[model samples]
Target: MTTLTYKADHHWRFSPILWGALVVAAVAVYLIFQDGVHLMVRWWQRDEYSHGYLIPLIALYLIWQRSDVLSRIRFDGSWVGPAIITLGLVVGLVGELATIYTVVQYAFLIVLYGAALSLVGPTAFRIIAIPMLILFFMIPLPGFLYNNLSSQLQLISSEIGVAVIRLFGISVYLEGNVIDLGGYRLQVVEACSGLRYLFPLMTLGFIVAYFYRAPLWKRLVIFVSTAPITVLMNSFRIGVIGVTVEYFGEEAAEGFLHDFEGWVVFMACFGVLFVEMWLLLRITGDKRPLSEVFAIDSPQKAQENEDTSARHLPTPFLSSVALLIVAVFGAASLAERQEIIPEREEFVTLPKELGGWRGRVEIMEQIYLDTLKLTDYRIINYTTDTEFVNFYSAYYDSQRKGASIHSPKTCLPGDGWRFNEIETHAVDGVTMGGKPLIVNRVLMTKGDRRQLVYYWFQGRSRIITNEYAAKWFIFWDALFNNRTDGALVRLVTPIREGADAAVADERLQEFTKELSKVLPEYIPG
Candidate 1:
């Protein structure tokens, strides 16, 4: 077998041009940090993402542990690194303009990977890829995806928790994400969605997989199983909390013991991860101890490997670095320039009387208003002797920041409503200028009560049906017209017992026709 080794060589290997490139790269990173400081703020404030602070430290340690192998590899930079660097810069620019931190963070990681490839060769890139990729777990999911996932996970965890409570001979009833233990009620809000455990455990799982001296498939299995393991353990935590609250008082679920239980559950998750590693060793007949299976570098070896690495002088990498620096300055300048928000009528001025229907405005509580973070909104109920329709609109003047319209699909289930069916309904005559107007038609039920809801996104100059499409248009319009104004309009009417579904549909269509006429003045289509 051919054996390769690196003797301790502590001298610098970069040429004058490469040294200049290094300075440019540092400038680029400083620009990125200007925008990325918010992530640090979020790490401190958001409990679920607090692990963000530790991710970089862990990733760095992993990369250091592999130093011995990386030092021996030859360095030949590739032009592909520059191409990737340019892509990352462009993505970062877009993200900064759109004011979406998730996109900006992804662009930052991509740029870092490109920089690594430019500093070393493809072999070193492959060796350090896992540790680099593990850094991704630090970026929080976008609001829309987070809301959808959190809502689903909350429901699933609640169901499993209630089932577990019953298994322990405690009578329990589940309504959506609400668990009723006859006397005490536990509502599974977004905080208890188990994402807190999932994010950190997945990060730990990747680190374990990197160190485990096993086959490729075995490593993947150990990594992939973290998700299911997190879900199961989190459900058990909720079940245990419910049982405690039933036996003791509500204080058990809220005070110091509650926090103590969370820590215990997290420790149990780690214990389970170690047990999994042990089982895999037994199955593969490796006969190695669990500690040895996932061993790290010794101090002597790490010190030896930390001496220095050979460097290459590549024109493409240097050129890419220069261009990236230029792009960073450009993005920073663009961020400083004020965006032109279009002047339009506000939803607060919406008329109470639309055509013949009598309307009454419903005011929201200050707490809900604060949570929604909307610019303006209206929740008006229009009624006739035979039927009642509720109209709601949430408007955002500038969606450049984190503020934007939320999808009702994510919000509906939290209030004990189960969706029976959802589909897009096309209304031909009800559209503006005789164009086809598409809206989401949904049927939701709770116990024996049922409601039909019709909703659509009213953008600057277009009416949209799909939520994803609305996001695309928001980005597009924000880019071109410098306008990110949009609003969500929803009309809901209850289907009375023994009432015909067709009649309710007709009533909504007729109301939408009148709505199309008055929406433009307020929403400015």
Candidate 2:
């Protein structure tokens, strides 16, 4: 018998490269602290992003699992790493000036990846690439992209959920996202919009894919399948809630059970993912047991004594210097760029009468105002002898951060009003500060009641109909003019019991003509 003995070598030595790397990391972290805080706070508050907190830990654990392989690779420092770091800093500077936290967060990850690449060359980077790529799941999607995705997901989930409810022999009426179920109405708000499941599940699927010792195609399928699985499962959850409400009353869909149901649904999503993997394995004639699928055992633990040589620490001096310069520049830019809160009269005294239409001012609840985060707003019920319309204008002095305008497409569904159609309508021969004015013409209905709404985003010197276009202008204006002032101006009129929508349209169009004249005074076009 041969006896093999291995020495456990443990040593701590601070090299110049290590110190340089630490200094660079410390400076980078310090510069991105504000963005980091905002992201963590959002993770705590937003359920969709709650999984963000665990992504980094998981990534680190993954790297540790492959430590043996990583440890053996010698660091071949590259100048490209410094170049990437410079690009990341430039991105952070742009985000800081624009007040877009998402950009900063993304830049933070880029800088982190660049730092790793700087210390270890391309070979080592490829070895630990998955963990670094996993960092992307931590950054929240930009607001514009999130809104569009949420809208589409909400609609898809709502449609499928309603179909499920119908299959259960429940009498259901679906208009947009509102489900009318005789006794209880279900509005598939943002929470029920599938994003609550998609984000977390996508993160989970990525992790599972990383661990799954399978063919590349199998792993890819497992990861990409999370989206549709999330959507389908969320829709099923909604359907289950509908059935519960039908039998057990609305209380079944609220309170503790509701929260529990969400957990159960998420767990079900995990089960579905596993089932998918199993089926794929069967299709490929791979007979590996499910238990044997995960590659969780650390390679370093298995082969520790095989190698004990100390490799020289390759300090990324160029990258470190570049990062330091960028951090300093970013901090200076942020400190110097003042938030331009342009002076404008408040919206309190909008007017009692406009274009011969009498108006009555109404106040929004404090809770709504808090959520809106607008600098000022005005809500008024304008009426004439034969027509009544609601005029609302919410103003944000600075929209680069939170408290931006909410699209009616997102808000109206929550109020049990289902939008039937929403399209951009160019209001010919009308102008705001002598520019073409376009508006989104929306037709919404709640049961038998119908309403016609016309709304547009009023940014400085622009009357935009598209919400995304408004976001673009906000970014451009924020960068060029140091201003992100904008307002969502909406006019809603009822399509009276027997009256045609055309009548309501005429009333809103006439009111808008008068509105365009005075909006510049308060909104500061």
lDDT of 2 at 99: 75
TM-score per candidate? 0.88, 0.87
Residue-pair clashes per candidate: 0, 0
Give the per-residue Cα lDDT of candidate 2 at 295: 52
Compared with the true structure, the alpha-carbon lDDT of candidate 2 equals: 0.77
RMSD of each: 3.5, 4.6
Candidate 1 clash pair list: none
Model 2: how far residue 111 lies from native, Å: 1.4
Stretches of candidate 2 above 4 Å error? 1-20, 253-259, 302-310, 313-319, 361-373, 409-429, 434-436, 442-451, 494-505
- Candidate 1: stretches off by over 4 Å: 1-23, 36-44, 72-74, 97-99, 260-262, 299-316, 363-371, 432-436
lDDT tens digits, residue span 1-525, model 1: 013323344423456666777887877766764565566446535667777888888888878776766655555667888888878878877876766666877888888888878767576678788889988888887767776888888888888888888888988888888889777788887767787778778888888888888999998998899888877887887788778877887787665336744556677888898999899888878898877778887423435434554466666667667777677767767766566666777777777777777789999888557546788899999887766889999888877555668788877887778879889999758775345788899988999898889998987778888999998898888667777788888999898877777778988887888778887777766
